[model samples]
Target: MPENPTTEPTPGLENLLHETRSFPPDPRFAEQANAQAGLYDEAKADRLAFWERQARELVSWRTPFTETLDWSGAPVARWFADGTLNAAYNAVDRHVEAGHGDRVALHFEGEPGDTRTVTYADLQREVSRAANALAALGVTTGDRVVIYLPMLVESVVAMLACARLGAAHSVVFGGFSADALRSRIADAGATLVITADGGYRRGAPSALKPAVDEALEPRNGAEPTTVAHVLVVRRTGQDVAWTEGRDVWWHEALEAADVQHDPVWVEAEHPLFILYTSGTTGKPKGILHTTGGYLTQTAYTHRNVFDLKAETDVYWCTADIGWVTGHSYVVYGPLLNGATQVIYEGTPDSPHQGRWWEIVEKYKVSILYTAPTAIRTFMKWGEEIPDRFDLSSLRVLGSVGESINPEAWMWYRRVIGGGTAPIVDTWWQTETGAIMVSPLPGVTAAKPGSAQVPLPGIAAEVVDDEAHPVPDGGGGYLVLSEPWPSMLRGIWGDLERFKDTYWSRFPGIYFAGDGAKKDEDGDIWLLGRVDDVMNVSGHRLSTTEIESALVSHEYVAEAAVVGAADDTTGQAVVAFVILIGEFADRAADDAGADAVQTALRNHVARQIGAIAKPRKILVVPELPKTRSGKIMRRLLRDVAENRAVGDATTLADSSVMTLIASGLAKPSTSSED
Candidate 1:
């Protein structure tokens, strides 16, 4: 990808570049961050000293660190290497010691309308008990534990317990297929597995333990798993086939265990958790984050980025425990800060479309961090649903997972924020462990679609193919010039892959795999993934740019654009769009669909240029997304290329592909004019 493409602006595209509204930092919240005054300057002066200061200030260390950072090894850097700390103690025991034991730690809302509130003291006791049970099961220091459970409190307890025992936990998303789970477990060589009998989804019980069973079974010439034991949390009490020697119930184990186990402090560089993220090659990379550095950055970023008011704010990060967002925000960050938060155990739309708003109103949630996918879904559902409820409690809104379109960003600010709150569009990944680029609510004047700038103390830039920094307003690959505290230590047991995937791309700089650009004010805008930038003729048009143009139209709620294989143009843009509330009903009629589709094609032509217009427009009810709400664009690429669809195991609803394929059989409302 080249930075600042020299191509002239496509004619008549000016209207699409609407002037974005600027939001200034809130006066009251601006001073709330303890490190706000001299943070960025101090970091710039000495990055090592800044991180060391954050490590010491954020948590109680059992042994003080002598070294701040050791980047002498180049891509494999170490931070606070000599320091000793316990993640569970920081997240739980220390908060209890501060006499904030009675403060609510988790406000668990299950999908079936059940709720449980756990205090810090209660959490500490539970974690201690679970730690003891793990010890009894022979889970020791440096051992890997695979946690495959839902958004239950037990899942949180199990993870903290693993931390308590100095065991690295790898949490596979509950929606992952047995093969996916098996591969992660096999790669990590996990000894113990924690799962639930079943979980609530779409207002009913869904079996999960069966997946674990299948994963453990050696089918299709696969070897038997390394898992020695499976600990089950009786979430829905659904009957599971018993494996006498391998399985034990959570209630049974905890019943026999004492709640007085002490947490052991480990070296700062000791592995905290192994989070497996998918690579382009279809292999799962276990992103490794350590104790002191990962925690320090996670806590620091969460506190300042969200402008968290620990005592006053009711925070909710709508991410599953499987991904990094949940690990950083829902578990470590919020818990370390002793912040009260809502943790839901189900999808946003199970019983009804307004479940999230109901929870927000019910809990008076002040800070809401969610993905753009959910926001767009809400847009599809219409604003009247949220209008029925009071949403004045929300003060800050956030976006994660992917780059939010300007249209979606504005709608999120205006509708969900009640036109008062500021939106923080965060950019980070599983490898980064915490937020890297994002607008600080009370600091920057935000651009709707842009991540704006890297967070203070983080050094990031958009660079051209030769690793040279691109000029302001230029488009290029995004890279981190300096090593940060929260960067992944290695790809578990595959240091070479870690280095090759991230470091090899840009020599010493960390390649983020995304395309980016800076505006006239030097604010950064993320163009989707580098692979997502399609070559149409000799012009490289980003899928994000085309999708943004499609979504800018009032009738389109969400849009996904893929470049299909073409003989003439090399790759032709094929778009899938979801219509807004009444538009769906209207678009269902063939005549209306053709008219609207033609208008949208012209809309994109006018927005960018005829070169960027889609060759076909398919209006569908839903796009195939993962359970984590990420659009599986690879599948869309397969659809566009007319290839046999690859594995649909990761999709939230794999059956949607059938409908889409069937829909594709009909004459498309396409315009090649």
Candidate 2:
């Protein structure tokens, strides 16, 4: 936690890539910005006082907190320990009470071209009714509920209803397998499940109830699950095997219940929700987030980071309800700020490739936030697709999920924002609960592909393996030197594991699993996860940098880099790239594919030094990605090392691995010398 640990140089990650392009905030944008340059100085003067001010100004606390933070428990921090609040009330009811009931809370756009608009009053009534229905089914304070539904309006209602009753809700992605769902259900000891019969995907009705039924079914020699009821939403109206005693229709339950329910006021440290993140071990880690502090930070960051004008701006974050970005930006953050937002239900390319732009144009979305993977996919589709649509309403753009390459960032700024909007590339994990490192959009001069710096109240630094802070223009591990409000309380049911995983790495500092580098200006640049760093000829190179180098090429649209075992170099870099739509035909033949791969290899060598060049480059049609749009580099490594593909059930399309593996058999460009 020392501001300056030892300054001794160490052999850590090699920062070989440099980005010099910078874009400052527009004068007009900065004039009306919510976060001014003075905010940083205020936070630096008194960090705790700054947070206490934010907590008071942003959130609607039932009982004001006296104590700001209690870090006496070491790794486990108690923020705003004496405060009391209700997340659902702050999100829904308070806006209704403030005469904003007529304001649009959600602009729901179904993938099948169906649409519905819900106001704050409408949301309050629905959430209250859902809470009543849940209470009738024996769900109350301290109870756990598992939600396994698609991106439906009811999904948001379900999460809010759980929060309203002080019951923790754990949402599992609808794309997850039955085994994955069952593991989360068992770990949370959930008593009820909320799901739809099915949801629309790619113009087809995909059954979801079957997965829920399979997950809840009796296992051989396993203990019975705690689930007492199954609440089903009729999204697709797909036929499902009925369990007469345990199942209840969503609409019927809400219709039968009263539309009036009281919000449960819980203490600051009360458990709000438990979201599961993938762990090194087979089991998923249930990240426990408490009530008051989590709401405080999420609301604060959401308002300032995007320079939100809640009354005028129509915000949209293209993340599903299952991910943490959705938990923060899509649900809690925007609603807490009384901002109207859009929520889509299907893939970006269902009926056509222009589906997302069409929605944005229809909604006049001003603030847009999405992942880099999505931007790269749009790049592969070409810029002409978005050029057909009117995106003049977009003002501020944002990126999340992972580190973005500079080319994708520039494309997004040019094509989507019309080269005028500032992009806020954010860095945070599921455990962090909200955005930690991000540009203020209006105050800071934005740097392409860099998170830039920690937010006003956060303390983050790049440190070497010896816990010494790396000097400016050095690369090392990213660590949080101080506790933040929204930091995860602990791994659910396993305090020791939480201590061992995050705390033990630096004794007291929370070591983020990702590696990072500091520029000459001391700005932080994320270098993906430490496990993805490749060791070639004793140089520890970042996969993100190599992938960025490949993507910087004009022909390349997207790239994924992995480290495969090499007898001579210990680990060699292998890259998979997708060409732009116009150039796809150039790589259609074996000879043409080899030519394109060779060009990309040379491009990387020139972008960084020759030591950072990819050992092998394969022109792939697509890379394996998860439902949340993160590339599965582990599976890519499996294909690169010539090993049998591992469990690919978690991928958005399991067949993607098969295609990538088969592509590996074709002629590839490689070098051994």
Candidate 3:
């Protein structure tokens, strides 16, 4: 018989995971939201019309848009082009005006057990006063203001106030260095800088005023700064150095100003915020999200994806306001829908490891959204800790930041949700302002690691290098084929870089910079970043998939994989892993550590094939991560290749990589040795 050429394996194609495990939504929730399943069909009929309807229905517009989208210029898309809307009014005022003024908007819990519940009415007054104060500080429409603060109500107020006054605000993460904050302020050409005296962290009052002062200092004997004023909030009552005329206290300023500023409507395309994201090279790219479209999608997604019941559900998204998740889910999304949410201002393990669970129990939080790294950390701490608390309030769980491993997903569902709550593993980025691809908790029978599909009105696909669609059970690049309302307008002041970074990859299609796979049922499973996809010889393998495979092992709790320089293959897989429970004790002894490393390598070989097995594995107490719980794989790659790590300053614990490097110096007993 002649050979069947079509059935043969391709030379350069890599082996892919055929993950078939699935979890259906809770029957009660599904029954309650039968109409949500119909949105897919409605959006399929006409995506533009669906978005137009969503925009009109979700937000209160001062001037309605005639056109839904104008994409003639390709990459530069304008959604709700002719619309005019006040983002702050849509987020706060409308809820209060509709007789929900007494509703609790933010249930703020401070690190020192201090609590404050701000209602819609209270929020409206605070925002109005803030807007008046900002205007008094010489801020006006289109002016840039930099907000660098902790997870306080003041941060939310400052953001909304900027929106109310039609000023574009840039929020720098409180954990960031002065250099990082300064670079963003310079990039945005911000005139006003808002910061707190300090914030509480790990049961200690950390001073932030010093960083702010240093950031404003003259560099290389240059001119002082472009900043006109520095507004300070007294959070911890910590004394700070006064800049005389340039500095003003929040209380004094707001007290002196009139609290009757009206919200101003801005054009739909007018920039709402300039959020800077770290790029692989050069300065961080300031992602620009505009008004009407961004707000509409954020509000709509928050309502549907979480199945938020504004009056009942106590929602919480564990993200800092410095990030996009905080902007959309934590603030704009929930407030726009009149939803009550818990906002905490401390690390999850501060004072107690059960802090998050305590808050969930205390607030009766029905919807819990958080990052997968935090989940893995919770898993590492053991289920017994959470077992001590009453987490029965949790009805729906969410995972973001990175593609969640199946093991972590199962742990999150079983341990946290008690196996009943649905998990909505979302896939989006800073570039896409809101959740782009996520399972509707009430509609999807979600697979453990897969995002399942794009939401209604979002067009996404897994395509090969030639821009052709990849077959099911194949791996390819993930791209958004259609522009959505919440898509970023451009990289602020660097339209060319934005075009080159996102659009130039696939011409018209928005290359998401992530590798992905389509399952046999055509559900999309996100692989990590395209840069994270390593080439072994000529075959491509996803670092996230391998890391998932590693974490699926009984002993491993969390894993980070990096592609290191290799002579035999183009790049070799190197892994740094943290063990928990019994594995941690076993890894303490030299011989047991050797045996465990061998077992993990074999485990990965069995689970994902030998090609995906790590060439080297280091059993470490911790992995390098940022304050936001993102693993610093770039530093790991540097360590793996035996090169000097560029910067360790951004790490939550700068000593972590040093510890890992020291651990790697020990002998290897594996067959790969």
As for lDDT, the candidate ahead, 1 or 2, is 2
TM-score of each: 0.97, 0.97, 0.96
Error of 1 at 61 (Å): 0.8
Report the poorest 10 consecutive residues by lDDT, candidate 2: 1-10
lDDT of candidate 3 over 1-673, digit per residue (tens) = 0022122222212333344357776678888762378899999999999999999999999999999999998798999889899999998999888999999999999999999999999999999999999898899999999999999999999999999999999999998999998888888999999999999999999988888899999898655578999999999999899989999999898888776778988999998999999988999999999998999999999998888889889999999999999999998999999999999999999889999999998999999999999999998889999999898988888988999888889899999999888999999999999998889977889888889799989999988777888777666788999999999999999889989999897889999988787777788888788778887766677788788888888899889999988999888888888887787788777898888888998888877777777888887788899988899899988888888876988888998878777654333467653
Quote the positional error of residue 217 for candidate 3 in Å: 0.8
Off by over 4 Å in 3: 1-20, 221-224, 664-667
lDDT of 1 by residue, 393-511 (tens): 99989999998988899899899998878888999999999999998776787788889888878999988778888776567789999999999999999999988899998898999
- Candidate 3, residue 576: Cα displacement in angstroms equals 0.6
Q: Clash pairs of candidate 1?
A: 3-475, 4-475
Backbone atom clashes (below 3 Å) for every candidate: 2, 0, 0
Model 3 lDDT, residue 500, Cα: 96
Candidate 2: which pairs clash? none
On residues 1-673, what C-alpha lDDT tens digit does candidate 2 reach at each position? Answer: 1123223221222233335478988889899999999999999999999999999998888899999999898789998888899999999999999999999999999988889999999999999999999999999999999999999899999999999999999999999989999999999999999999999999999999999999999989987999999999999978999999899999999999999999999998999999999875668999999998899999999999998998999999999989999999999999999999999999999899999999889999999999999999998887889999999999999999999888889999999999999999999999999999999977999888899999999999988878788888777789999999999999999999889889998888999988887877889988888888666766767788888778878888888889888898788888888888766688788887778777777777767767766788877778899988999888888888999998889898998888878754354656544
TM-score of 2: 0.97
Worst window of 10 by summed lDDT in candidate 3 = 1-10
Question: What do the candidate models score in CA lDDT, each in turn?
Answer: 0.88, 0.89, 0.87
